[model samples]
Target: MKKVNFRNKDMAWDISALILYPPGFNEASQYPTIVSVHPFGSCKEQTSSATYGKALAEAGFVVIAYDASFQGESGGEPRYIEDPSQRVEDISRVIDYAVTLPYVDADRIAGIGICGGGGYIFSAALTEKRLKAVVGITPVNLGRLFREGFSQYNPVAALEAMAAQRTIEARGGEMQVNELLPATPQVATENGLTERDVFEATDYYKTPRGQQPGGATRMLFSHAQKTLSWDAFAYAETLMTQPVMAVVGQKIGAFGGYRDGHEIYGRSIASKDRQLVELEEWSHYDLYDKAQPVSAAMEQIVPFFNKHLS
Candidate 1:
């Protein structure tokens, strides 16, 4: 794998990415390519690269795993903003860069997004016609995640708070940041989140299991409004027309991934083809990096891309 950079011209920022080539790569030969997107508040190196980047490259496809705008090694102001609209646009920008390469077979392109990345890829497929196939891995719909929460909440309250924070920031006050999950396992227990998936998330994002410099588990408080209101699976039956597959784990507790994955698959009746693969033993975070769960996911994932992008 080698480093590459491209512009998100719409957002006026740059995306930092790792492009992995199949063995004995040659510029003269065109190959099917995939854009691997990382989860919310995560970087390319954590799951996208650490798990799937090299695997897909070895499977004989050119793969580009990228850091989202305003996070990881990518460039943007007021960093750590996990905006769904921008994130969805980022995939297309990467596709723009991918097609320009001499070795890429633009017509055979597909995408797989992890967690929030999964939602973004789904949203991208709703309109991005160039994508022949798309997959959602442990998909989290930010709108559903925020609005519904563990039980439910008055989203107006959260939106009001976000507006207040933006006002403060406009006055040159300190920017507020919020953690995506309990900071640690102990913290999770103290907060009464003793689920297997929640604990696994704390382990992966907060500890050495998945921690990295740019993969911060924080997002801007001011930007929460957009995420709270945007539904990742909105208009699935009408808008999404690409071949789709949702690689989901058994939902353990109130986790958003399982719910969103099934939601998208069930709703996308208009897709060219739609499939959902559920690994009963795995939880949401288990699919993030665990060997057994990851392998199971790839079994469904690899062939879908292979068939559609062939």
Candidate 2:
């Protein structure tokens, strides 16, 4: 593993990343590459690295896992804001950087994203023709989640409140933020977050299972404006012509990745090679770092990319 950095398109900030090369990698020859994306509120050091990034590299691909702007080791101000548009663009930027490498096979580059990164990777592949093959490991469509409340959320009402807060902040008021996960599982139980997804979220994100600095479960409240309106899979059926795969755990609810995985596979009508895989016993977060689930996921991912990325 090697740490690297590159300026985004605008050169406004540097995106921090960890690049892993397959064994016997050579600079003299090109290799198929993957831009492995971390989940929402996650960084390169987390699952993107611990699991998929490493796993894919071991499977004979050059994988780069990066931190989104304003999150993790990446540069930007008002940190931890989950900007949907920015996240989508970050993948493109990573690809832009990838193409510059002498050892990267420009036409064979692909992307695989976990959790929200899964959704963002799909969004990226919609327009990024350079991404020959794509994978979404339990994706969460951010805009859809915000617009259609995961848990009795009122989109209009929430939008109204977020608009009000943005106005206040623009007028010199204090910045407000939203917490993605409760501080602890016990706290979650006290607050009545009893759903399977919520419990697993608290366990995976709040505890050592997947926690990392800068990948904290928080974001600027005002980011809701764009998040609520953005649609990760909009026009996917018409525009997403790339080979696509949606790997989801059957034990998903509230988290919504299962629904999203099924939706993308069904809706991307133009993707003649699209696939949907449902692992029966694994929950949403189980695929993030668990041995059994991650290993199971790799079985499908390695062969798919191997066949498609040629």
Clashes of 1: 0
The CA lDDT at 266 in model 1 is 96
Q: Which stretches of candidate 2 lie over 4 Å from their true place?
A: none
lDDT of 1 at 183: 81
Candidate 1 RMSD computed on C-alpha atoms after optimal superposition onto the true structure:
1.6
- Alpha carbon deviation, residue 172, candidate 2 (Å): 1.7
Provide the lowest-lDDT 10-residue window in model 1.
145-154
| Count of backbone collisions within predicted model 2 | 0
Identify the runs in model 1 with alpha carbons over 4 angstroms from their true place.
8-11, 150-152
The collision pairs in model 1 are: none
For 273-309, candidate 1 gives per-residue lDDT tens digits of 9999999888888888889999988888888888999
Worst 10 residues of 2 by lDDT: 146-155
My TM-score estimates for the predictions, one after another, are 0.95, 0.96
